[model samples]
Target: MLSRNVYPQTRPGKWSVLLLLAVFSLLIVFALIVQSGQPFNLDTLFDNGWAAVVSILAIAAAFGAFIVGLYTIFRNHERSAAVFFTVSIGGLVALFVLMQLFL
Candidate 1:
C-alpha cells in the first residue's frame, strides 16, 4: 500500500470573511452612488479634501490586498498574504479613525 499522505485542505479563517465583507460593503456604497445618479468622478473625489482622498486609497489598497491574499491562498500555497491583507485592512481602519478624529 502507498504510504505517503498529502493534500491537506484548510478552511479559510476569519480574516478572509472579514475582508470579503468589507469589500462587499464598499461595492454596495458604489452601487448606491450609481443608482443615485451621482457621478463618481475625479472632480468629485478632489472636492472632498486630502483626508477623503487618502482614505479612499487606503480602502482600495485594503480591498486589493484581500483579493490578493485569497488568490495566494489558493494558488501559491503560502499564508504570508494573510499578513499583508490584515495589515492593510488595519491601516484602512486606522485611517478612518484618524479622519473621524482630526479631519
Candidate 2:
C-alpha cells in the first residue's frame, strides 16, 4: 500500500487527519462555488444586500481557513500534508481569481 505520509503517524493522527480532510474539502467546495458563481444570480444578489455581503465574507473566511490549516498542519509536523494543502488551496485560489476576472 502507498503510505500517505501526508499526516502524522502519531496517536493524535486519526482525528487530526479527519479534521484536516474536512477543512480541505470545505475550502475546495467553497472555492468551486465562488468560481462558478453563475448559480448566484447577480440580479437577486442585492435582493437582501446583506446576503451579498455575507457571501463576500464567506470568501474571506475560506482564505482564513486555508492559512489556518497550513499553520496547523505544519505545527503538527505533517510536512507532506502541508505541501498537499498548499498546492490544493493555492490552485483553487488561483482558479477562483481567474474565474472572477475572466468569466
Candidate 3:
C-alpha cells in the first residue's frame, strides 16, 4: 500500500491580514462619512489637511497590505483562500485609488 504525505496548510502572516482588515475598515468609515451627506467631497478632503492626510495614509496602508500579502504567499507558502482574495482585490483597489487621486 502506498500512502501520500499531507502537509499542514500554512496560514498568512499576521501583518498581512491585519493590514488588509484595517484598510477595509477605513474604506467603510469613509463610505459612511460620505453617505451622511455632510458636505464632504474630494475638494473638501484636500482643503482639510487632516482629511487629506488620512486618505493618503489609507492608500499607503492598502499598498502595504498588498505587498505583505504577496510576500507571505510567495515566501511563506500561504494556503489561505482569504489571503489570495485580499492580495488580488487589494492590489487592484490600491492601483485604482492611486490613479483616481493623481490622475
Candidate 4:
C-alpha cells in the first residue's frame, strides 16, 4: 500500500495561475507579430492592430495575475512557485506601464 505524505504541499491559487498563463500566452502572440522580420517599434504596433490589442490583453492579464497572486498568498495561504512567478510578472507589467506614462 502507498502512504500519503503527512504534510500536504500547498499549490498556487487556481485563478492566479490561469491569469499568469493568459499573460504569457498573450505576450508571446504579441511578440510573434511584432518580430516578423521588419523594423520593430511603437509604429509597428500601430501598423498591426492585432498586436496592439494583444498587448493590451497581456497588460490586463498581468495586472489581474498580480492582484490574484497577492490575494492567494495572503488570504488563501498558497505557497507555491507559480504564485511568486505571477507576482513578479505582474510587477514587471505594472512597471512598464508606469514607465511609459511617466517617461
Candidate 5:
C-alpha cells in the first residue's frame, strides 16, 4: 500500500512545466551554439584555463541554486522556490546565449 506521501507529488502546473521546458530547450540551443565552433574570445581572466574555470563556476552556481531552491520547496514555499529556480535557470540560459553570440 502506497501512502499518500510515499508517491511523488503531482507535477507542477502546466505553465510551470512549459516554462521550464522552454528554458531547458534554450539551454540546449546555447550548448549547440557553443559546440558549433563560433570564434569568439570572451575569456580574459585565465588565458590558459578559462574554459575549465568557467565550466566549474557555472556548474557550482547552478548546483547551489538548485540546493537552495529544493530547500525552499521542501519548506512549504513552493511558489517562491519555483520562481527562484526558474529565474536562476533562465538567467543561465540567457548567459549561455549571450556568450555564444558574442564570444
Candidate 6:
C-alpha cells in the first residue's frame, strides 16, 4: 500500500529516465530532418550534421533544465523551479529556431 504523500512524490530516477527519453526523441527528429534534405542556414552554421548536433545539444540542455525543475519542485524550491522551467522553455524555442535555420 502506498501513502498519499508517496503517490504524489517524484521518483528519484524519474528525471534521468525522462532525459533519456527526450534524447531519443531528439535523435529521431534529427534523423528525420537529415533524411528530408532541406536547406537550412542561420548565422554561419550550414551543414546538416552540424545543425543536427546543435539541435541535439539544445534538446539535451533543455531536458537538463527540466530535470532541474523537477528536482526543485520535489524539494519545494519554488523560485528555482520557476527559473528552471523558464530556461527549459527558452532552450526548446532556441532549438526550434536552429532547426528552421540550419536543418
Best by lDDT: 4
The superposed Cα distance between candidate 5 and the true structure at residue 64, in angstroms, equals 0.7
Q: Candidate 2: where is the Cα deviation over 4 Å?
A: 1-47, 79-94, 98-103
Alpha-carbon TM-score of each model against the true structure: 0.36, 0.40, 0.68, 0.73, 0.35, 0.36
Give the Å error, residue 25, model 5.
Answer: 18
lDDT of 1 by residue, 1-103 (tens): 8442232233343445455456556656655544565445656555645435454754674655455555546665544434444546655665775788898
Q: List the residue pairs that clash in candidate 4.
A: none
Better of 1 and 4 by TM-score: 4
Candidate rank order under TM-score: 4, 3, 2, 6, 1, 5
- Residues 32-99, candidate 2: write the lDDT tens digits: 65566455556665554555565555455445545555554567555455445543664476479679
* Candidate 3 residue lDDT tens string, 1-103: 9542232244445676677788877777666655665654456577655556666767777788788889888898875766776688778978798898899
Residue 88 of model 4, lDDT score? 85
TM-score quality measure for candidate 6: 0.36
CA deviation > 4 Å runs, candidate 6: 1-47, 80-103
For candidate 5, lDDT tens digit of each residue in 17-91?
345555455456546656666566746535435444544455444444444444445554455435455546745
Worst 10 residues of 3 by lDDT: 3-12
Work out candidate 5's RMSD over C-alphas.
10.5
Residue range 1-103, candidate 6, lDDT tens digits: 8322311224433453345456556767767776676765534434566555857675665557555555645575343333444446646755786788898
In candidate 3, how many Å is residue 75 off? 0.5
lDDT of each: 0.53, 0.54, 0.70, 0.77, 0.49, 0.54
What's the distance in Å from true for residue 72, model 1? 0.6
Which portions of model 4 miss their true places by more than 4 Å? 1-12, 35-44
Better of 4 and 6 by TM-score: 4
| lDDT score, candidate 2 | 0.54
TM-score of 3: 0.68
If candidate 6 were superposed on the true structure by all CA atoms, what would the RMSD be? 10.1
Candidate 2: which pairs clash?
none
